[model samples]
Target: MGGQISVRGVTHVYTNRYTRETVLALEDISFEVEQGEFVCIIGPSGCGKSTLLYLIAGLMRPSMGEILVDGRPVTGPGPDRGMVFQEFAILPWRTVWRNISHGLEIQGVPKEKRDEIVRHYIRLIGLEGFENKYPYELSGGMKQRVALARTLACNPKVVLMDEPFAALDVQTRITLRTELLKISLQLSNTILFVTHSVDEAALLGDRVIVLTRRPGRVKEIVRNPIPRAARDEHTMENPAFIEYRNHLFYSVRSEVQVAEHEALVRG
Candidate 1:
């Protein structure tokens, strides 16, 4: 079953290692992600979208407030939460099957069971034939599919993605988006996806969380009106999708402008 996430008044601060200069990244940010919910977070560059994910992943501690996964406070990285990064962080030496089975191996699952799980995910990601292929031999999209399959094989309660599709080309990105949506629906995964594209957010998210400029705060949390089953290529042409996309684009653009101005001032 998917886990519910509760982020209560969370704030994060970063300090330059050498200069010891502190900067506020996220401020008083609070939100909730229900079990099996697909939540996408969008914000201006450096507005701490990735930072927020790290906080929830327990990779870093929030300066203030708390992040809870299924009612338990996040203290450090755990198997209950899985993260997929922009970079395809799969092992180059491992074949697609091996990469997908890595997590299950870590859990000490028997080879027979691990093989079964890995094969299932390979089919899930449409990489059945490429199971023997190494990372370098695969396309960018295929590698990401391997990475995602690896994460999903662990059966994490919540899946966190940090621009997982941002590195792909346009066509590949679109293709993977649909594949991911299908897989998510099939698995009923609880996902927290962070992206810079408003259209992507509109297409993939049950709710979109927009953040303000530096010292990022929750600007708004917009619920997607389009039903998940109805979200497809044709859905982009629908008026409701356009309206949601435009609303998010404008909201994010405003924050981007503010961030640029602040950068100029700092310069």
Candidate 2:
């Protein structure tokens, strides 16, 4: 089952060890992601998008407030949450099959069950023929598919993706977005995806949360008017898609300008 996530009055402060310089990364960020929902977060470069994702993943803790997954406080990384980073992050030494099965092995899933799960995800991500190939032998997009399959094979309640497709070329990124939509629909996985692309957010998110520049705060949450089943490449050409894209672009652009001005003043 997919997990519901609640971020309550969260705030984070980062302190540089060497300089002792502290920066407020996120403040009073409160939001709830419904079970099985695909939510996207977008903000300026310095805005705490990835920071918030890490907090939810239990890789880091907030200075204030709390994050809960399914009414349980997230104290640290656990099996219930899976993370796919921008980097391929798959083990070089392991072939595609081995990489996808690694997490199940750690969880002590029997070899037979692990094999079943690994093969399922391999097909789900369309890497059926490449299962024996190592990461170095795969293309960038193929490697990312392996990374994603590795995360999905474990059946985590929540999937946290931090720009999982940012490194791919335009065509590959587009293709993966569609594949991701399909996977999410088939598995009903609750996902929190962070990306800088307004178009991506508009295309994939049921709701898009926009954040301000520094000390990122929830500026707005826009719901996509386009139905999930209808969001395909052709959907981008629809009037509603264009309108949503334009709205998000303007929202993010405004924050980008403010962040740039702040940087100039600091300089």
- Per lDDT, the best of the predicted structures is 2
TM-score of every candidate relative to the true structure: 0.97, 0.97
- Span of 10 residues, lowest total lDDT, candidate 1: 180-189
After best superposition, candidate 2 residue 177: deviation in angstroms? 1.1
Q: Number of backbone collisions per candidate, in order?
A: 0, 0
Give the Cα lDDT of each candidate. 0.92, 0.93
Instruction: Name model 1 segments beyond 4 Å from true.
Output: 262-267
**lDDT agreement of model 1 with the native:** 0.92
Q: Which stretches of candidate 2 lie over 4 Å from their true place?
A: 265-267
